[model samples]
Target: MTTDLLSLKARWADLRQQQPQSRIRDAAQQLGVSEAELLVTGLGETVTRLTGDFRELLKQVTSLGYVMALTRNDVLVHERKGVYEKVSFSNHVGLVLGPDIDLRLFMNRWQWGFAVQENGRKSLQFFDPQGQAVHKMYLTDRSDEIAYNRLVTRFQDSQQSTELAILPAAAKEIEKDDTDIDVSGFRHGWLDMKDTHEFFSLLRQYGVGRQQGLRLAPEGHAQLLSMEVLKRIFAEAADRQVSIMVFVSNPGCIQIHTGPVHKLATMGPWFNVLDPTFNLHLNETRVDQVWLTRKPTTDGIVTGLELFDKDGQNVALIFGERKPGKPELTSWRTLVDDITAAAIS
Candidate 1:
C-alpha cells in the first residue's frame, strides 16, 4: 500500500507547523519528493493544480497587472517587480517584454503549475518534469488581485485531484556524461560564431557541454577568472555608473537585467545586488569557475564573463551593455579589463 497525497499533505502540514520559516523547496528536499509533488499534495486546499491550459495561463497572466517575476537556478536567484506585457510566443519559445520584467521562456519544459497560497502569500509556480521550479509570479499589493482570482477560477482543474505525474529526478545532481565529443568541430564552431546566440547551436552540434567547451576552447578565446573578481566587477560598475547586462538562467528561462547596479553587498556566502526594483542573490560558495570568453561578432569581438557551477551548469553571464547596431561600450570593456588586470595583479 502506498501513502496517498492527502495523508502525505497532512504530514507535511504538521512538519511545516514545526518549522514555520522553512521554504517549500527546502521542505520538499527534506521529504525526498519533487517540489511539484509536495505542492500538489495540498490540492483542493491552499493549492489548485492549473488545468491543461498552463501555457495559456502563462500568456493570460499579463492581465493580472503588476506582479513580481522570479527565475533562479541552484546558485543564483533573480527577482524583478513589474508587469508581464508585450507577451508573444511562437511554437516553443515565449517572451515577456515589459521594461521591468523581461524573460526568454522555453515553453516545452513547463510541466506542472499550481496557483498556491500559504499564510496569505499567494503565487503561481511552474516546474519542470524533474520537479525543479522554472519560474514563479507573485501578486503584489499593487497587483490586480481581482484579475488573479478570475484567472484561478478560469484555469482551475475540473477534477481538483492531487495526484500528479512527476518524473524521477536525476540520480546525479550534475550530469557528467560526456563522450565522443567533437573538440575540433566545437573549436571551429566557436571561432566561426558570428553571434552569441549561435553558441547554443555549436554546443548541440558538437555534443559538448558549456564548461567542457570552454575548457577545450582554442587558446586566446577563454580564460578562467578568479572568484574575487566578481565582487570587484559589481563595485566598479557601481562606482563608475557603467550600465551592464546581467543574465541569469535556469533550464526553462533566462532573465536579463540591464542597467547600473548599486549596493553590491556580501552577506556570508551570498553575493547580493540590493537594488530597489531588481534583486540577485548568488551563492558565492557554489561558483567553482568563472570564464572570460571572447567571441567574434559582426560588430567586433565581444567579451562575456560567464560563471559556472561544479557540474558545468552556467550560473550567470555578464557582458558590457551593447545594442545590435552599436559596438560594446568602452566603460564596460574597461571595467572587464580592470577586473582581468586585478586578477593577475
Candidate 2:
C-alpha cells in the first residue's frame, strides 16, 4: 500500500501539470482509488505524524533561512541567523532561543500555522490553552523592536476577546518584573561609590575615561557587572576622594559606545535615580542631563572626580561631591558619602 501511494504521489508531477487545481479527492474519483488512499498518498505518513514532520520541516526551513514551526504542543521559529524562538502552545512554558542557535522541538494540543511578510518580517500566531491568541508576534530586523511589537500586538488582539485568559496578564507582569529587577540592581550599584581614584583608575584601565562616555553593544545590556568589581571601586573611592557621591537613576538596560570610538557592549543596571520613568534617549541632551545632575557634587572642594569604571573583573562607579562649608551641608554630605562608600565597597 505504501509503495503504491509513493508511486502515485511521485506521478503527481505529471498529473498536477495536467490538472493544476485538481484536488486529491477528484483525482481519486477519476482513478477509481479510494479517497482515503488518495489523501494518504498526497500527504504521506508525515502528515499523519504532524508534530514530527513539522519539526523535521523546521530543521530544513531554518537551514535555508528563517522558519516558523507550529504543532499541537508548541511553536518553534527561527531567523536566517540561526536563532530559534520557542513559545508554548500550552500554558506551561515560553522561551526565546539562540545566542547560539539550536534546533528546538516541543508539543501542543492543536496544529499551528506560520506566515511571513514581504519585508522579511516573520509572524508567529498561536492560541493559548484557553484558545486565545496569546502569542502573536512579529520578528523584525531589530530584537527590541520585534519584542515590543509582539507584546503590543498580542495585547491589543487579546483585548477584545470575550474569553479572558491569564497568559496575557502573566506576560505583562513578567515584563514589568524584569524592568524592576534591572532598575533595582542598578540602584544598588550606583549607591555604592567609595574609592574615587581606584574607580577612575579602573575605568581608565578599561578604556572608559572620565569625561568621556562609552556606548555598549545592543545585546550587552543584559550582561551584569560583577559584584566583586563593584566592591573594589567603592573601596578605592572611599580612600582618595574627599566626598564620593554616586547618582544612579533611570536604571534600565543600554548598549553603549565609549569615547570617540564606537566600541559596543550591552551593560546596565542603568540609573535614572532622580526619575523612575526616564528613558535614555541616545543624544547629547541626555548626556548633558546626566552631567548637569552630577557636576555640582564634583566641582571645587572635591579634588578628584571619576564616574563609571570597570576593571577586568568588575565595574566601578565613582564621582565626587562638593565639600560643604556650612555644618548642615557638611553633615548631610558626610552621611551621603558614607552611604555611597559603604554600599560599593
Candidate 3:
C-alpha cells in the first residue's frame, strides 16, 4: 500500500502539471486506481480518525503553511536588499524572513552575518537548509547594543505579525475581471446673478443659505448655492403665481425651471442650465412627488431640485439619454440677456 501510494502521488503530481484542469476522479481512473484510495491518500483520514501528537502536528503544519502561503508573494530582490541595508544600520531593525528563500541567499549575497553571541557567552545562530551557519556575531555581557541587536534580528526573522501578501497573480486576475464605463460626451453648465436680492433674502429668512448654480448637458441643470436658497425659492414661487420644477442628475448635476411669469417680468435669481456629456439625472417630478407623498414638509421648501451627494452618482444620470424638446437650454449665451433683464426688474 505504501509503495502504491508513493507511485500514485508521483503520478498525481505529473498529471497536475500536464493537465491543470484534470479532475481528481479522472486522474484516479487514468492511473487505474479506485477513487476511494485516491481520496484517502490525497486528503488523509477524516479528523475523527486522527489521534495523538501526529494529529496535532498535522493541524499545526497545515494551519501554519496556509498562513505563510497567504503572505508569501515574490518581492523584488533589489527592494528587499534596499530595506535590509537601511535596517542593518540601526543595530536593531525588525524584519521577517519567510520560506521563499534560504538565509544564505541574503547573508551570503549581502555579506551580512546571521548568528550572534549574546551576553553570558550564549551563542545565537541561524541555519540554512543544509544546517550551515548563515550568520554569526558576538556580544559582551554588559553590551546593551548587542542585546538590542539580537532582539531586533529575532523579531525580523520571525514570520508572525506580517500582513497578507498581495501577489501579482491575484492583481492580474482582478484586472482581468474589471470593467470601466465611458462618459466622454457628458457636459455641464451653471447660472449666477447679483440681482436675485429678494430671492436671496427670502432664502435667509427660511434658513436657505448661499447658493451656486450648476448645469448638466442635454437639458438638465440646477443651482447648488445653498439649501436655504432652495427653500426660499420654492416658498416664494409657491406663494406667488409661478410654478417651479427643479431637476437633478443622480450624481451631482441640477436643473431648475419656473413657469407662468405673471406679475413677475423676470427670472428672479433662477437660471436655465444643463450638463453636457456629464453623468446626471433630471428629477423633474421630485417636487411633485414630495407634494403628493410627505406632510408638513421639512425645514426648507421642497423644490423639485434633486440633490446628488457626490460626483460619482452625478455621473450616472448625466450619461443617460436626454429628454425630448428639452428646449435649446444649453444655449446660455442667448438666454443671458433675457435673464439679466428679468432679474433687474
- Decide which is better by lDDT, 2 or 3: 2
> Each model's TM-score?
0.91, 0.21, 0.17
Q: On a 0 to 1 TM-score scale, where does candidate 3 land against the true structure?
A: 0.17
TM-score of 1: 0.91
Per-prediction tally of clashes = 0, 40, 47
lDDT of 1 by residue, 35-66 (tens): 88888777777898787756678788888888
Q: Write the per-residue lDDT of candidate 3 for residues 1-345, one digit (tens) a residue.
A: 367666777888798899987755467668775433443343222201111221122122211121101100011000011001111111221222222211112321111112222123322223222222222222333334544343434433232211112122112111111123111222111122222223334333333222211222123223323333333343344344343332221111112122322221113332222221111112222221111100011121111233333221221111111222332122222232233334445
What C-alpha lDDT do the candidate models reach, one value each? 0.84, 0.31, 0.27
Q: List candidate 1 segments past 4 Å from native.
A: 1-7, 10-19, 169-185
Error at 154, model 2, angstroms: 26
- Sort order, lDDT high to low: 1, 2, 3
Which numbered prediction scores highest in TM-score against the true structure? Answer: 1
